[model samples]
Target: MTEACERPEATAGGAADPGDPAADRLEVRAAVFRGDDGDRLRVETLALAGPSHGEVRVRVRAAGVCGSDRHVLDGEWNVPLPAIMGHEAAGVVEAVGAGVRGLGIGDHVVIAWHQACQRCGECAGGKPWACTRARSNDSLLPDGTTRWRDAGGSEAFPYLAVGAMSEAIVVPEFAAIRIDPAVPFDVASLIGCSAGTGFGAVANNAEVIAGESAVVVGSGGVGLSIIAALRLAGATPIIAVDVSEARLDEARLAGATHALLGGPDLAERVAEITDGGADAAFEAIGRVQTMAQLPELIRPGGRAVFVGLPPEGQKVEIDGLLLAYEGKTIIGSNYGGLVPARDFPRIAAAYRAGMLPLDRLISARVRLDEVNEAFEAMRRGERTRSVIVFD
Candidate 1:
């Protein structure tokens, strides 16, 4: 852990300011990213202010380093400098701001990156994932300012506003989805991102029915989650594709009936397995090369879901004429087309009932200090998911 500041409020009978009221702040150790090129994460002590109106402060316990985090680290995604990166996390609520209801300190919750502005058109249309207010990438707080400051008084932005990589974070009350205490923090953390996204891609986006054939490209965390959802939906011949043998093995454990290594002949192999093409195909790898194959992997009148996030501004060429003639559909899912408030708890229930194998998705756990190593492992596709566990 990098020390950015000495422990705060330890002097003079635990007073932050001798003459002032008790400090309403939390000092925490966090992995701070200076820029895209630097592999070294500056562990720093940072101050997190108490939650403001309509917000809640959470003491994060378990966070997953997702592919989105890698996108920023590898300069594939755009984020402000000095970002505290990590979005998929579960924690205990430490404090709730005024006007925040239904949540109290000590409640176990999952921090979602997207929060709906309930009055927005998207919210009213039941597509909260498209709410503009929930998509801010800046480091500013909800009130157009920042609540985090480092030792040098430099402002640090929380990646996607939930910055779960830190020991603590202040997010909108809606961003904190309460979970049952019976669910372990490590398992719940994934529900916030990977599980939700993957599950949503099938249940809400593709709407795959039982007995239909499905092809999932990429066997990483999200990919495996999609495969699990396909199984729950009773999809037949659930095919998993990946270049990594280890990921293919994990895919099989996640309920895939067949696992195939990705290559130039991947679509051909999938066609042979499904006897023509799958009913639905999901591209979870987020590359143009893989995304281009989605249309070819599915049969006529089938749906192709793009669950993987390609780097910003990156485009994949597709057969517009073929799609139009075949009546095939391709859709992009942001955060799995899910409303965290409504979907998270259901996913938790599914996990409890043994429908979603979230435990099998977690391959390793490390302390916050070892987060960079986790990132490397994710890049190498060595694990389905690696979590940062904070005691």
Candidate 2:
């Protein structure tokens, strides 16, 4: 488990990063979030290093601005201040840590945030999402400290252990998944979070049957990804509900058979559209009210898949009578039931064959400096996914 991670490039003040060209140390840029100052901005001159034991140093190329990052930006989920926030990313393997296998320097890969220790009971039992060690481990180098530092000699943390918004980062080898060479970093970046989670919802959690009808609440990147998976699953009536017309249109393009503008009493509208109830319903926005209505939309014995994570500490409203009478199953899905090694490649293959329209899902692509703008766009509901593309 001992790994000698890349040393922070030698620079000024004998700082950790000495190789940044801008500051005579390692050149790194990232979208950082700070709660105390209500600060969310792009930070340049952040220094990074190569991987340590079981780690891989990635020279990040592109990172998607996912809803999860938006959650961090608003301070709903508290991350350590000065933490690099972007997680759904794609990059090149700049270096490999000791004991790292199946990857090498110069390899193009998509960054995965959830890393599991294989020996754990959750991992051995096929539920790596429930990895017991995820919450406890810091996922840093062999030492207890980090590989990144700011100009003032302050330690900086990467979010979810990936932090792909920066120029380069040292992270666990399991966080980097090799992607097809042909896919652009922008497109492949979706594999990092939006695509992987969305596709996994229907395919893995719901196991959607062909010709079954489905309703998806919220049509952002994740919601639309669910539509795409349902389409490939041969689901016939793919109804997309959203507050935004643009997202609904995106959902339609992703294979939604019908689009409904979300209104007050959304469940009532769903009941009317589906002629009493849908075969399955997906709640992607993560609001209690929206999640609460899932039972009302599904047919008896139908499944309601909760896709989005509501703000931290928010409890979902549940009606016991409706569930008991309807025999409906309400479930929360994390990372779309994603098993990275198997699902990541399958999603890439589908995208390569022209069946999955990932390129269309991108509303805008900006540099790291524009990350705040991306978050603003997400807040205003102006775009589906604003991805960060680096050089």
Candidate 3:
């Protein structure tokens, strides 16, 4: 497929100077997934178009390797291929497009994957997180086009609309939420996804209260963030369950009050620790079995928040009778029910105040070329999070 590189007409703020030939295009190194038989990522030089109207060009500093990106790699989530993957990222603004405001060059930003259309009902209703017009999942910009093309001129979609694994990217103005320059890019990268989702699940979805008990299933980055948020919410006995003891250790450091190895007796162990069941349960890994097990891990009338992204077409069978009889609730939280414009700064502030130990979430720092190794480590459950640091 071919696309023209014609610049959109500038608006009030004036877009990247169309006459300045240097501002029109850039050649950058990006990790492109071809969806070939082996499903590996290739670092290729691609042509990156400058930001269009209401967008900004960013030089990616750091991006977190997340499970959602893995799902696309593993063919569980069928996004457009020959795509640039990586959503949770931090970067510096290099240029702004027409109509852009409140952000400019050199500003540090967290790349919010979900660029909600403000006019959508959900967005207008103050729940931009649930905006009906989000197109990131389509891997295209709001205009249904991509800014990346290979040397051969084949269009490459940006995974989740950010494609942050690249050396540089162009994203919607709303997607690039500015933060304090003092925040490290590695820590800032996580606020876009894992940290935001985990914390939002507790504060918004579950409405976790002080002294309430909670259990977090899966001790990955998102799970660890849940533990930290639970602690901040004054929740007691924050139980963390994981199959890997090493991850459980990480969970403890993230503020889990009790750690339990996950297995057949996991429920019994959690019940023992919480004296029957916890007040809330968070399933951060999207395995069907674990998603089904969430209701059992919480007390009657408790909330079960699903923070992880399950493979497309996958379904879990919940006990409807038990759910109705016990007055339990199951909530699916997308992007942590976050409004990037609002929550990104709040998360940064929390990090600055030492309320969120975000640095603990970074288990490894790898270059773009070493990203596959990072994924391997993730497959072996050896990392809380691996960040790809750009030069």
Clashing pairs in 2: 3-53, 9-18, 10-18, 11-18, 18-25, 19-25, 19-26, 20-25, 20-26
Which ranges in model 2 have alpha carbons more than 4 Å from their true place?
1-25, 36-39, 136-145
Q: Write the per-residue lDDT of candidate 2 for residues 1-391, one digit (tens) a residue.
A: 2222222222101212223322323557776665655646666677765455566667788889888878777767777667877788888876555565566667788876777666688888877777767731353432455777787878888887777688777766666788787988998989888988988899889989898989999999889888888998898789999999889888889999899988677777777777777888998886878887778888888999999888889877788987999898987798887888778878899999988888888989998888888888998888999988887
TM-score, each model?
0.93, 0.90, 0.94
Q: Quote model 1's TM-score.
A: 0.93
Worst 10-residue lDDT window, candidate 3: 1-10
lDDT of 1 by residue, 145-250 (tens): 6678888888888888878899998888778888888999999999989999999999999988999999999989899999999998999999999999999999
Better of 2 and 3 by TM-score: 3
- Candidate 3 local distance difference test against the native: 0.86
- Point to the candidate with the largest lDDT: 3
Distance from true location, Cα of 136 in model 2, Å: 8.2
Per-prediction CA RMSD (Å): 6.6, 5.5, 5.1
Ranking by lDDT: 3, 1, 2
Per-candidate clashes, comma-separated = 1, 9, 0
Which lDDT tens digits does candidate 3 get at residues 167-253?
999998778888989999999999988999888899888999999999999999899988998998999999999999999999989
lDDT of each: 0.85, 0.78, 0.86
